[model samples]
Target: MSQKILMVDDEADLSKLVAHHLQKEGFEPLCVSNGSDALKALAKQPFSLVILDIMMPGEDGLQVCRKLRNKEETASIPILFLTAKDEESDKVVGLELGADDYVTKPFSPKELMARVKALLRRTERKESASSYAYRDLVMDVPRHEVSASENRVTLTAKEFALLEHLLKNKGKVLTRDHLLNTVWGYDYFGTTRTVDVHVRRLREKIPLLTDAIETVPSLGYKLVDEE
Candidate 1:
């Protein structure tokens, strides 16, 4: 089945243009003129991913993204922000708000399509993996569930992906850039700080991981056995 991509933008011309390109790329593109309609559409149906514009008539992209992340049913859907704002702060805020990627205005259609493919590919790859375990932490890929020390651990989608990567490479030191490229995909424009944030979250959720996940100053993180 063709993946459904929700394009939420107030610009009619741009939204139509993007939707055309998305269609050519083998995706079913659905467009919404405002954040309000975007939320309504999202609640009514499922989309493989969301292409959100930062500025809109009502609740804006950031607000919509925040609400999506806060809701369990829609939280895991990947969000890519399309905005005219290119400031570092804006990009960082979008990433922190659970946006998987960001594209500035006047972007090349080729690049945008490439990023869309990358994001979708990463999500599919993670979701298709078999269940894995590291000591007491078990990751159930099909259900997108995780448990540590026999207790359920609630993690955001990104956190779950990061933990799964660490578990797969236990005993190997993974640099921040490596983690960003591997877990977030190379199309992600954010810096390595995102890796640190997710790592901290994993440690907090699974206290046992605090001792197992080692911090190598000036390098990166390593999932190693506690000595």
Candidate 2:
């Protein structure tokens, strides 16, 4: 199937032009003029990615992004911010809030399409790599299976996602909020205690890596190299 993209922009002409270009590139583009409409579209039909304008009539793109990120079902869907602001801080805010990518105003169709492809490609690779791991700690994402040292470890969907997120960021400290936003998909309104619960459960299943994951105490958790 062709890649499905949802585009939210207040500018009618720009939205049309972008939709046309994306269609030509073998992508299925669905354009909406406002955030509410974009949400409506998503509720009615699902898409692989969303291209949102930061400013709009009723609900702004940032609000929509936040809402989507907070929802469990739609949170993992890739989000790309399309806006006129060019400040570095603005870009950081969007990414920090869970926007996977951003495109400035007056962007080239070719360049915009490139960003789209890159995000999609990276998501695909991550999905594939987990299943294709060379280590005995095997992860069958699609099948929801994990094995350490050739021993099977049962895990819930959330547990697996949390582990995948950490393992993918191995050797890095993942803040509690970051994990909540990324793994739980902005939908979880729970406290940091939620992360702790899952992490402990995950450790119980894979006891061999108990020391590999460290608690930040009053902060977050990190997966590090074992001695």
Candidate 3:
């Protein structure tokens, strides 16, 4: 069955163009002009992914993303922000808000499709083990759950994937490029700063990881294995 994708954008022409490409790629695209209607569509049916625009009439894309991330039912759904805001701060804020990917406006349809496919692929991929652990932190892969010192820790999809990769390669110095390719997909168009943002978030979310994840200046990060 074709995957269902929800697109939230005020631009009618752009929405139609995106829908056309998504259909050609064998995806069922549903376009909504505002965040309210977008939420309505999402509540009405399940979607494989969401393409959201930052600027809107009522609630903006960032607000919508926060609501989705807070809701248990929609928290796990992957979100890609498509907007005209190309500033580094904007990208960092979107990523911090639980958006799996960010694409600035004037984007190529092909690259957009690539990002869409990458997000879906990441969500659908399965790990061999049911869970992974490092110190007091435990990650239940299939269950999509994480805990530190017996306290539940919530993480966005990208954050979860980032931590998963780090735990899998504990003690190894993973380059930003390597982490980006492995966790964000090789087709990811973002820069290494994306890795730094996520790593900072992970540290903030899981206190146990604050000091555990060592930063190699001018290089990348490493999750101390302490084995």
Candidate 4:
């Protein structure tokens, strides 16, 4: 079966164009004009990915992205933001809000399609192991669940990916650029700061990791066994 992708954008012409491209790539596309309708569509069915526009009438893309990340049913679905704003800060905000990728307006169809495929590939990729643990913090890869000190921890999809990478390569110094390429994909448009933000979040969310993730001055981070 073709994977279903939800495209939420206020621009009617753009939606049609994107839908056409998605269909050509063997993806089933569903277009909606606003956040409310996007949410409604999501409630009715599961989608493999979401292409969201940042600017809209009400409950803009950021709001909608937040809502989706908060829901267990929709949290892991990849979200790619389509926006006219090319500002760095705008892109950062979208990523911080749990968007998997961002594409500025005036984008080429080739570039957009590449971004879509990258996200889908990342989401669909499977881990070799079922779980990873460090002290009291444990990540159940198959279940898409995490716990710190036996307490369930809520993490966005990106956060989970970032942490998994760190755990998989424990004791190795991983640079921010490497993390971005591995976890966020080489197609990611943002800066290394994106890696920093997500790493900070992981440390914050998993208290045991506070001192565990050693920050190598001017280098990157290394996950070491807590002494």
Candidate 5:
């Protein structure tokens, strides 16, 4: 099946033109006129990517992106924001809202298509990995499964994220603030205790990892003895 892409914009003619181009490129385009309809469309379809315009009648692209990211099912959906707003802050806010990319108004069709293809390629790469491993420890991200010593382990999103971070940087000592910001996001600050909670839970899940990950006391943690 061709990859499905959602286009959310109140500009009917512009969306239709883009949809025509997208369909020509072998994507199934679903067009929505407002944020509510966009959310509804997402709830009903498994779109490969979303092209969202910031200026819409109802809720805007920012709100839609933020809400979609909050929902577990749609959290990883690739979003490319289109806007007439040209300020640097607008782009920054869109990115912080979890938009995968942004395009300003008057963007060339060729450039837009290139960005769309690039975003989808990146998303496909991530989905292809979906899982990471070190030794007997496995983190199946899409399935949200973690295991060690040939047994399944249950972990919270935070705990699994922490473990994934450590395993990815197996031999490095990641600072508390770095882990906190990366996994929990920069919106969460001052409560460094959250990192400790996740680390403790991760250790509980993989007891053998107890020694693999060493606490630097007041500093952070490191995964050594890597496989």
Candidate 6:
């Protein structure tokens, strides 16, 4: 079945345009003009991803994001924020609150669609070998599950892929470019910060990797063996 996406934006024209494009891309897009309705719709339905506008009446995007993250049932759903505010702080705030991506205002429909596709692609469960493990951290590839010791660790699709790549490489430092190419695909137009965001999420989810994933100054990152 085609994935369903929820787009919450006060701009009726923009929502229409995005919904049209998403339809053409074989997705079912549901548009809500306010944060209240968006939350209501989310509660009623299961959406694969949410395209949220940062500025809205009543509960704004950041408020909505925080609520979503707090909800156990809705927390893992991916979110992409649409914002006219291009400030780095705005983007950082959204990312820190669990937004999967952000697109500035006046963005090309094509580019937005690309981001949508890449984000959704990450949600697909990867079917591969049995598992990949580094000590107590284990990723069951076919099952799309990750666990530290015996406790499960919840990771987004992007985080899962990033951790998998790091586990596969082990000790080698991977450049951000290489990680972006390998994990997000070559056509992904996002910056290296996207990699950093997912990596941070990974570390937060798997506390055992607090120091395992090292940041190389003036370079990229490496997943090292636990001493």
lDDT leader? 3
Write model 6 residue lDDT over 1-227, tens digit each, in one string. Answer: 99999999999999999999999999999999999999999999899999999999899999998898777677768899998989888887888788878899989999999989988776676455557879788888887778898897766556777888898899999999999888878767767888887788778878878888999997799999766
Off by over 4 Å in 3: none
TM-score of every candidate: 0.87, 0.63, 0.95, 0.93, 0.63, 0.90
> Clash number for every model?
0, 4, 0, 0, 0, 0
Compute the lDDT for candidate 2. Answer: 0.76
What local lDDT score does residue 19 receive in model 6, on the 0 to 100 scale?
A: 99
86-149 in candidate 5: lDDT tens per residue?
A: 7877876775566656789987777777778876654442455457778788888777767787
* lDDT per residue as tens, model 1, 101-161: 8899989988999989888877774445789888888889889888877887666667778
Clashing pairs for model 5 are none
Candidates arranged by TM-score, highest first: 3, 4, 6, 1, 2, 5
The candidate, 1 or 4, that scores higher on lDDT is 4
Highest-scoring model, TM-score? 3
lDDT of 4 by residue, 1-227 (tens): 99999999999999999999999999999999999999999999999999999999999999999999888788888899999988988988888788878889998988898888888877764756579988898899988899988998888778888889989998999998898899878886667888887787778878878889889888789999655
lDDT of 1: 0.87
Clashing pairs in 1: none
lDDT of 2 by residue, 143-185 (tens): 5567899886655445667788887887788999999777755
Quantify how close model 4 is to the true structure by its C-alpha RMSD in Å. 1.6
On the 0 to 100 scale, the lDDT of residue 103 in model 1 is: 92
Each model's C-alpha lDDT?
A: 0.87, 0.76, 0.91, 0.88, 0.77, 0.86
Clashes of 3: 0
Give the true-structure RMSD of model 2. Answer: 9.4
Candidate 6 off by > 4 Å: none
